[model samples]
Target: MKTTNYDIIIIGGGMVGASLACALADSTLKIAVIEGREPPAEWPADSFDIRVSAITRASENLFRHLGAWEEMQRLRVQPYQAMEVWDATGPGHIHFEAAELGEPNLGHIIENRVITRALRQRLREHHNIDYRCPAHPKGLLPLIDRAQLQLDDGSRLQAPLMVGADGAHSWLRQQAGIAVAERHYGQTAVVTTVQTEKHHQDTAWQRFLPSGPLAFLPLPGGRSSIVWSTTAEQAEHLLALDAGEFMAELGEAFAHRLGAITALGPRGAFPLKGRHAKQYVKPQLALVGDAAHTIHPLAGQGVNLGLADVEALAAVVLDAHRARRPIGALKTLRRYERARRGDNLLMLDAMGAFKSLFSNDTPGLRELRNLGLDLADHAGPVKNLIVARAMGLDALPAASLATS
Candidate 1:
């Protein structure tokens, strides 16, 4: 079969994949991004996507570096100046303020569609990248020095390096014989947009219930995006409620913190699971973004972690090129894996710990966690560190020794 060759072909052109392409747009290498779906051309102001991300400042910096942040801002993004967290069943609670850190805002809450749209637009201007959207994968063939992808159109594409940014159920990773360890959290995240009786004051609020954590993220026009995690069955029940009933239950659940939820826009629920690939790379095949690791969304750091992966992978690839080494070689790919896996694993573990500690109502553990929260809140330096760590501001820790 005839094959079109390039230096790199990335599968899945979501935020992370597209960001990688943008990162290398000015480089000498030819790159191609094949996405299975096309992003929407416009996001109507009156409607909000249920799937939104709490974008860390680090991710904002990344997009700024790639020249995409300004374009995203033009579309509409809500920068939250503060965050409030409290346990619904206990006295554990704390608040984080960007003012304390001398920063304008803690982060922005943006629709996933907005991010993908901004990235797709940026991809159009990059001369080095070939954007192939609405494309489907047919098969894969791994060779000695390169990997090949069979497209649905019966055409094959070859690249010295093929990356899987295709997400949690990555076809490329499976085709490359990479294994993943997965743990289903048995919880579903129900998301929707709501209008409250009072203004949010540009603050993000999170309340921990026994079922899971629920976040009320600030948005424009005194609206908020609600991400309520709960048992799957309960999630289904919540989705089935009429708007008025849903708003009633929701307002009560949040203790009417923002006052009554007067209106609800739309609702969606997604299953929660944590997955870690057994390996991030092998030979000429590699993985990034959700293909490498997926975490619980309680902390709203999922995309931030994925973007960090993009940064590390891009740096590794460029450094390999500078050293005149094959970018897809095992040694070169391992460097990228080594630079990322530990930090990702640490975060995954932390999220799991949070879920375990907060999801239980055991008297002893409850007291322990509440005490810890109170201590962390009162301890200025420690609270700052925790906030910094969640913001992806802390230095990336060393990757595990044996894993990659």
Candidate 2:
């Protein structure tokens, strides 16, 4: 059996793990990324991913700090200048503009593959980091001073700290005995990209329907991506639709705002749920990204939240290392948990409230919620506050999310 050693081991070399590797690249510590799948290669110029994210300014800063943003810019990203949100039942609507906030753009709509490829490219350039593909941790053996990892390929490695960035079903988190609070939303999101007859003008649109929220995020080249969340049966039926019929249904749902919608790509559905680890750390192990928590996609904040987690955890670990403290010390890990828990719980709760509020068929409740939106739209101070919060600008954010 092969034996290796490292100062730290990060499981799941996805976006967050790769970003962490780049952040720690300059450190003297030895790092290893244990990945179950091969890292993504550079995307072809014309390729598009169905999955996309709204990247906030803070998330962009973290990617820049890790040297991945430059690569992403070289690839493809669409900057959205405005956002329009409306409720289906009433004339309640709200609009946010980047210009109003004295910024060039609110956020960017970026393809998931582009970001993943860029991060992987950055990771490849770091000599201090070891990229182990098609690797899985067989088990974790805790020691007084360090922890031992037994890999599926009959390899042994030891590290003072192990990070689980392994998505919602994190093996490391489970192995470390971390409990998670989970709730099923009884909904599913159908995602796809569509070509529109008219240009989107770099604006994103969202509508709250009786079933769920449907969002059309503008993409470059006169195209847009859709995230339509609905009840399980509806989602299944939509997914089962043929390309032409599906686009017809989508056009009706979106009210054909971008003119005639045509040419639907492959459609995929993901069950909607909220999950948060009861604790973020245990002894020598720490969880980040989806491993730590997952919120509803209604606000388009899922990846942004995970990126925030990455940024905060990275700063805490780096600061501890600079101070010559144990990187895996429980006291140090507590700082990370403290910084993220409240914000994560808030997002989860807010999404839950929105889901329940919109899903109700009661006329009175619908009127009240729509009226609330109308009121917020006319209230300058309240509108500014909400927009700032959505852009990740107003709150006293974690160090990683702080803009310069």
Candidate 3:
């Protein structure tokens, strides 16, 4: 038996990859993170990135466990106490509140860069984890017991375990011959910041329309981060609209929910593509985060799901370490795959169903979904169940419970 310079080599150093590195910081494992891009810089108070995520309680706990939560808080975070959801075509509306669950808050709206920056900052003090930036794989070689990675810089590294935390178009997943199921929703999400005439009241607002769903995520200073999912054609046109016209159309789409839209900020659009790798592990290689699965952003659960992947993978690896098993063996990695694959698939299917149900303008579906929403609102148990699930405090349904 031989010990490599690194116990594990992880590719991708964004939020999820960085998270995995941070999670392993306290361990004795010698890990190296290979990333092609430069690390995120510290952000100023008033500056917010175009990308943000609704960090769930589960993810928050993971960040806390890794000691990155404090830096994130000190930099920026907006804790929303309530969530308001409704159908735009009709009167179907339901709400989730933190008080109902006896929790202090549902979650926080955090900038994506801020999180990566914090993770990178935390990695600075971790002597065991090496952060390699402006680097990528030129080649990968999987041996009988270990893997060799050749970087673009003509450098070589070997490890007993390798992880692909690289996002949607994962190079490592492809190299491992993993299959993926990808579905394009035929919609693009247009994201931007806006000012409402009325205060956000620390609540997240969303309205499902025939085109897609529109979310008004509360930010600081009465501003809200809006994610409008709509057809590609409409998304192009919407992005073309000047600030004034765009603001007008936004208010109309939202029906002036928080009064009129007073101002608009930078806007960008991304095609909504749902993806899931057929297998999370192959021999000494494993996949995590977006590399394994990507969900609809309507619920702002994409990043949350990725962070959860980090947490689960980290736990499985640590447990394997305690058992003195090769961390990347199929036997060791399958535990993580089994723990996460089902939950990830469930969320993907649920979001796809919601996309189909709410995007249809059929008279029957319109009435049926609206009625369902109202009924769900009045059903305390059902509503509580939903809130619990959204807060990530609910337990995963066991096979017995699910089958029954």
Candidate 4:
């Protein structure tokens, strides 16, 4: 088999892996990014992609630093100035406005395709980065000093560090003998784009029903992308319904908060689960993105967390390389793990608690949650703290300076 060598091997070319490569663009390290499938040359300009991400400011900074933000803006992005979250069953509601916090906007919602397309564009400009699409990993062998990956083409690539960004079901994680703690939420997220009778008004609206939270995130052109998390059975039923029937049910469930659902786009569904790797690093192998952890989407922080991982890992790796240290050494990689594991765990637990608290129908619990929401709404300091953290501006992680 043909053999190639590199300083770093990144598995998966989704948003996370691609972002990591871009984060390291200034480095001299030879990097290989392997992705099994290639994205389309272009998406339909008239319609938005069903999958979208609520990008926090910190993540936006990282993209900007990588020089991809301009192209992304040219393609399309929707900025939400405010957010409204309330309980569907009770009189509990909380509103967050960017003006209240002296920020221009809460965050921007962009389609997943836009993110990947932009990142890939940045990858092309870096001479040291080799993005290999249409390549699948067939085998992995981890030695004391390096981990070797065998692609389906019968070619082998060896790297001092192998980073897994392959997502929740990470093949690299499994090959490295890393185990994950997983929780199946027994929920499926049904996603689609729709036009409402009322304009979204640059706001993100979410209602926590007994089943799960339903989020209406504004898209450009007065349309909204909806993520409705519900029981697997209910999701199946919802998908089985005709477009008109589904739109009617969706309108009723949302209480016509945006007047009515006037049009529907393509619909898709995926099961929900929480997963965290038992170990984030093993000698020459390390994991990032969904390969490290995945949380419930109730808070819309999953991609943000993954971007933070990229920033932290890039810092440690680049710092070590500049210092003439072994970037793949366990000690060197541990810095990335230590910086991210705690934050990721906290988010995972918080989402789990929120899901438990809001997904129940107990009368006493309902009253308590409503009261808690009211109290939080009234508590300015507490409310701002929550929003700041979600916007990823509170701690100011390596994302702000990692590329510098």
Candidate lDDT scores, in order, read 0.87, 0.86, 0.86, 0.91
Q: 319-351, model 2: which lDDT tens digit per residue?
A: 888789999999998998998889989989999
Q: Which tens-of-lDDT digit does each residue in 11-129 have in candidate 3? A: 99989999888887677999999988864575455666778899888788878877899999988899999999999878999988998889999999988888888888887789998
On the 0 to 100 scale, the lDDT of residue 102 in model 4 is 97
Best by lDDT: 4
Evaluated against the true structure, the overall lDDT of model 3 is: 0.86
Query: For every model in order, what is the number of clashing pairs?
Result: 0, 0, 0, 0
TM-score of predicted model 4? 0.98
Candidates in descending lDDT order: 4, 1, 3, 2
For candidate 2, what is the TM-score? 0.96
Worst lDDT run of 10 residues, candidate 3, spans 395-404
What RMSD does each model have against the real structure? 3.3, 1.9, 3.9, 1.1
What does candidate 1's lDDT look like per residue over 1-404, in tens digits? Answer: 78899999999999899988987666788999999998778756788888889988788888888889998898879999898999887888898899998888988999888899999999999888989988878999878799888999888999999999999899998888888999788899999999999999999999999899989999888899999999999999999999988998899889999887866577888899999999999999889999999999999988889888888888888877767789999999998899889989999999999998999999999888888888888899998998887776774421211112
Model 1 stretches with alpha carbons more than 4 Å out: 396-404
Off by over 4 Å in 4: 397-404
Question: Regarding TM-score, does 3 or 4 come out ahead?
Answer: 4
- Preferred candidate (lDDT higher): 1 or 4: 4
Candidates in descending TM-score order = 4, 1, 2, 3
Model 4 local distance difference test score: 0.91
